[model samples]
Target: MLIGVNYHYIRPWYDEPYPGIHGITPEVFEHQLKLLGRVGHFVGAAEIGEALAGVRPLPDRAFVVTLDDGLREQYEHAWPILRRLGVPAIFFVNTAAIAERRVLGVHKIHLVRAWQPPEKLLERLGQSGRSGNGGQMGALSDVSLIESIRRRAAAHYNYDDPETACLKYLLNFVLEPAVRDRLITECFEEMNPGAESEISQRLYMSGEELRILSDMGCLGSHGDDHLPLGLLTPVEVQREIERSVERIEAWTGRRPEALSYPYGSAEACAPPVSGIATDLGIRFAFTVERAGNPDLRAPLHLARCDCNDLPGGKAACWEADRLFEEIPRREWYLDEHVA
Candidate 1:
């Protein structure tokens, strides 16, 4: 089976009482890598993307490692570990943030919430008119409260999405670019004054650094603006996807073959995206929906497990390991609404 593991941040983690935002720490990640090294043939995502029928069948334990988003954390903390362990992986990036030095919609929300309560931010958006309490914001843990505000207030924002993800839609799609940028800048400045100049430098890797990593492993597309492709017009989608490929190609001296969807879920891997990938010569497109690929002759629409959801224990390493096994039953998601 061909499996891909999806990871984002790899920062230091603690057993905080509340469900504070967390990711696998570098130490734990190395433990997981040790498990993978023992049980599977870990391959680069690009090689997996290229392994069509012309190649022999991959071992049942074969897997690829992938990191989503071009967070500076990965380029700093995770890459060193990957290099030390000789573990190859693909790092998918959003070039717009790199090029324009702007905060992503999610990060914009995060920066605000980091300093102020979600209720305060919601009040700022004036989403609920009152504080965000009606949605049970107070009952929820901090992380959950963020979702509460985003999802419950989405209706007021007139976003069509049914989940907490509507905030992304509102921030990235509903609001005009200039308007959203100003909001993010204002929020950022309030929290960390005089930090505007360092936002891009602190948040993402430089192009020269990316080119060097490409030489080490592979660099792939995660769109330019990092918005949901299904939500954009066909022309806009083309601009986002094509420009990412062009920018990465220009920097790395090779057109990227892999294109992991910007959220890598929902509309992230659907009609317009697949069509764009086909047109632009993207060999593989990844999704967050977890599954094992029995056949990879055509690498589009491949499933990946989020690192947070990655299982543990020695038995978890077996060929029939339940985590990697048991492909979750999915509806014809392509036909469903981008919820």
Candidate 2:
């Protein structure tokens, strides 16, 4: 079976994690990579499109490693490890974040979660961020407070769009855009005062850095702003994909052949999204659908697995992986994140 796996963050083992962001230690990631090396034929994401187009056939254990979001963490923490291993992977980027030079509301939420107490932040947003996850947060335990906030956010974070669910609901839908921006900016100021020009750059890879990765692996579009395309207007969706293709090509010279939906799961692919992608001549599309992609005909809506979910027992894990596409991914993400 051909499988796809992805990651979002990697951090040092002993460092305190920033809240609202999930990370695996470098030790864990390396272990997983080595495990994958032992079992699968590692390939880049763009290659899957070729297999799908019948240009080539995929090997039994063909797979790709993809990193969504052009985070600095990918460049700082994940890049060296990938480089050291001589692994071929894909770094999917959302270009509007660079074009606009502002932090996405979701990232801002993470930053605020790391900077302030959950209690205070919850109170700021008018929700009780406390959770009954059997943990108590004292005023002095910032880590505990962060966990509490995270638990609360997870309770409602249905998908990766990070808006209209938990903190996203309050920040993205409830408050006006300007209001949300001002509030998040104010919260950002509390942590970092007047040092705003490079916030997005600090958080994500620079064009030069991404271009370097392009030579090593491949670059693909996550979206223009990393927002869910299914939730956008047709024009908005087209623009998001088109602009990302343009910007990434501007950086790397070749246009992107693959795109993974911003928060795509199996249920997240809209008809218009596929329609637009076809119009753009995009070759492959990926979703966090947790399965093997053995079929070549259906390339635009391909499935991917989370590497962290792959271990525990190879026999049982392999058996269960096939069911991922059969199961609707929205409910899976909801149950996993909030249930």
Candidate 3:
């Protein structure tokens, strides 16, 4: 069986004015890696492919660490610790951030929220909705729509408060991409004038750093623009995947064989997204679906749990062995032929 743990925003501290970005400190990350080491053997992308191809047998309770969004902190903080501990990790990157030095809309929301309050953001979204006509953001004023958003927020972000979660869901998933981008960019620019280039440099790893990671065989594609694929048209999805693969290859001198879907949710990784990835020569993919892969029946739809759902996380079990006991297996694997 394969258990995957996903992480983002690993830093020394989260001293934002408010609770906008949530992640573990380097000390906590190291402790978790050590704890995970006790319960399962750490594997890498190559080993996973080998095991799936029947070239090598996987150890019992094998797990892999994946760092998404290719944040500089992963290289600066997490990579050194991983190197010291002999743990292998895959850093999945969004090419636009690394190549064009642009901040993604989702990250813009994070920075805006950290700078201001959720209520303030909701107000701005409402203003944008008014200007954009009655779109999804207009539902902010509808009691029923607000309630539905609250429920989804609770489901996706159980760690956040009701207000914060609702704000996040609306910004990240509900609003139209064009509207969200325009509104968020306006807000972000208001706070950091002419600083997008500066922020991008600090927020993400450079091509040289990514090349170093590629040399270590730890880099993967997280798509371009970081938009959820399922929400986009088929053509747009292909562009997102292909553009990322091409740019990453050009920058690093290696074509990425793995992908971690942007958002990694069912709505984001649905249908042709996986088939398109396969056609594009991606060997495997990951989703934020919380479960373990008992077999490689659906390599592209492999499930992953958040770091918080495993040992040494906020919602982790006290005993590492007991972790899998609570997580159900991917029952769909029974319906497909084992790879």
**Top lDDT: which candidate number?**
3
Model 1 misplacement above 4 A: 13-21, 127-182, 313-320, 327-339
- Ranking 1 against 2 by TM-score, winner: 1
**What's the count of clashing pairs in each model shown?**
0, 0, 0
Full-model lDDT for every candidate = 0.67, 0.67, 0.87
Best by TM-score: 3
Worst-scoring 10-residue span by lDDT in model 3: 330-339
The reply for model 3, stretches above 4 Å from the true place, is 132-134, 331-339
1-339: candidate 3 lDDT, tens digit per residue: 788999999998899998889899999999999998988899999898897788988787888999999899999999999999999999999999878889888888888899898889888777777776537666577888778878988898888999898888877788778877878888899999999999999999988999999999999999999998988998999999999999989998899999999888777877678888888889989988788887777888888989998878999743687865667786432333321
lDDT of 2 by residue, 1-339 (tens): 667778877677434343456567777777777767776677775567667667887777766888888887877887788779877788888887777776776577777766565556645654212442212212314766545545544544534333224454445433444545666777887777765557887888888887897775478889887666766788988898999999888888878888888766433466567778868878877877766665554567777767655652222245334433442233332232211
Candidate 2's C-alpha runs over 4 A off are 13-18, 127-183, 312-339
Model 1, 1-339: lDDT tens digits are 767777776778544332223356787777787766776788885456546635655666777888877887887888888888888888999888888777676566555645554445544544432354233323434677556656644733331334324444545544545555666667777777876548867878898879987886568888888777876778988999899989888888888888888766555566666777778988777877656666663466777766544554222423434544565533324354421
For candidate 1, what is the TM-score? Answer: 0.78
Comparison by lDDT, 1 against 2, better one:
1
Any idea what lDDT model 1 has? 0.67
